[model samples]
Target: MRGTDWLLLWTLSLLWGGSFLFVELALEALTPLTIVWARVALAALILGLALRLTGQGMPPRGLWPGLLVMGLLNNAIPFVLIVVAQTAITGALASVLNATTPIFTVIVAHLATRDERLSPAKLAGVGLGFAGVVVMMAAGRLEGAVPAMAACLAAALSYGFASVWGRRFRQAGLAPMATAFGQVVASTVLLAPIWLWVDRPWAMQAPGAVPVMAVLALAVLSTALAYLIYFRILARAGATAISLVTFLVPLSAAGLGWLVLGERLEPRHLLGLALILGGLALIDRARAARPA
Candidate 1:
């Protein structure tokens, strides 16, 4: 990956890292489906306006099928799964499970694509990075959280497939912003009926100011803006590489806690950071050694 790709990856990590907090807050007054629906729906509206303001047209109709698949894999399924899992488990454990995305991506991409074959270095790096996440988060007992843990793992696997599947848009020369907008719009469309049936937002009391703000942040910053960077990195860095953002997400979350909540960074955090960075470097070096 290039320097810009790294920058985008870190930026995306920061954006998505905060999403766990947002979802937790939103859940105070909203159900999982309601939060997921509001996220994609409002993100769609924002991205649509962004498209119109930038004079970028809607994605061509031919791309609709792909967009819908992307929506399902990337947004609807994983978003709902993660949110629901968070209801049963701490976000730190969820994040640790989420970091397995790249491991799944590596395997999926190896079987599903001609390029991006699995490599020993990549495997080592993924293992090291995952260990780093476990160390940094100190993921505790899972005595009663098996289902939620499974949900998180399932979400990570969905994300893995989505990363590989999304490469088609880049191959087809779609702009990142347009692809982002289309997927979110498709997700909103897909979730609307389910949200109506399950959440019945019309009958429920309105959420409090904090929860409402959390939902808005989830939509605008985490969903809309984050997807823009996501697709860009996907186009530039390939699926397995982009999925490495999951490893960095915990670091970003830790940084945010330290900065915003005055949480002290422990020595384990530094050790974990070192291990994660080393893993990333090994992966990059492996990529660099590959023939063009």
Candidate 2:
């Protein structure tokens, strides 16, 4: 990866890592459905205006169908599932489950297509990184959380499919802004009815300023701008590299906990970081060896 790719990788990690915080706050005032819907809807609106302001128009009509499927896979399914999972499992546990995205992506791509074959290096990397995540989170309350854990893993698998599916946008020559905009639009279209029926957002009491701001941050920072960076990186880095952000999100969350909330830095966290980095290096080496 280039320096810019690394920059965007870390930026995405921070943005998505922060989403757990926003989800927590938003949940105080909204249902998971409402939160998920608002996020993509607002992001779509913002990106739409940004596209117009930047003098770029919508992507070709032919691209909308694929983009809609991308939205359903990438944004709608995982977003809702993860949010619901958080209601049942701790966020750290959810992160650990979420870290499986690249593993799923690698395997899914390997089995479903021709190019992204699974290698020994990838197996080792996934094993090591997954182990690190387990240690970092020290998650043991699994007996009662099986359903939630499964839900989170389902979300990761959905993300895996989304990563592979999103590759076409590069071939289509769609701008990242347009791709991001289209994705959120489709997510909103698909989820709006569910949100309205389940949440009836209008009848709910007004959320305080804090929750409102949290939703805004979730939409603007994580959903909207993050997807812009997401597609840009995906276009350059491919599915495996982009999916590796799953591993970083947890690490970034731990870092934020240490820095912002003064959570103590344990040795296990450092060990986990080392393992994940080692795994990434192996993955990178494998990527370098593959024929492009």
Which run of 10 residues does model 1 get worst, by summed lDDT? 257-266
The TM-score between candidate 2 and the true structure equals: 0.83
Local distance difference test values of all predictions, in order: 0.81, 0.79
Off by over 4 Å in 1: 1-11, 126-143, 229-247, 257-281
Give lDDT: candidate 1, residue 92: 50
Writing each residue's lDDT as its tens digit, candidate 2 over 24-81 gives 6777777899889889989989999989998987989999999989999999999999
Q: Deviation in angstroms for 248 in model 1?
A: 3.1
TM-score of each: 0.82, 0.83
CA RMSD of all predictions: 3.8, 3.4
Q: After superposition, how far is residue 112 of candidate 1 from its true place, in Å?
A: 0.9
Instruction: For residues 231-256, write the lDDT of model 1, one tens digit per residue.
Output: 77887889667857856887776666
User: Candidate 1 vs. truth: CA RMSD?
Assistant: 3.8
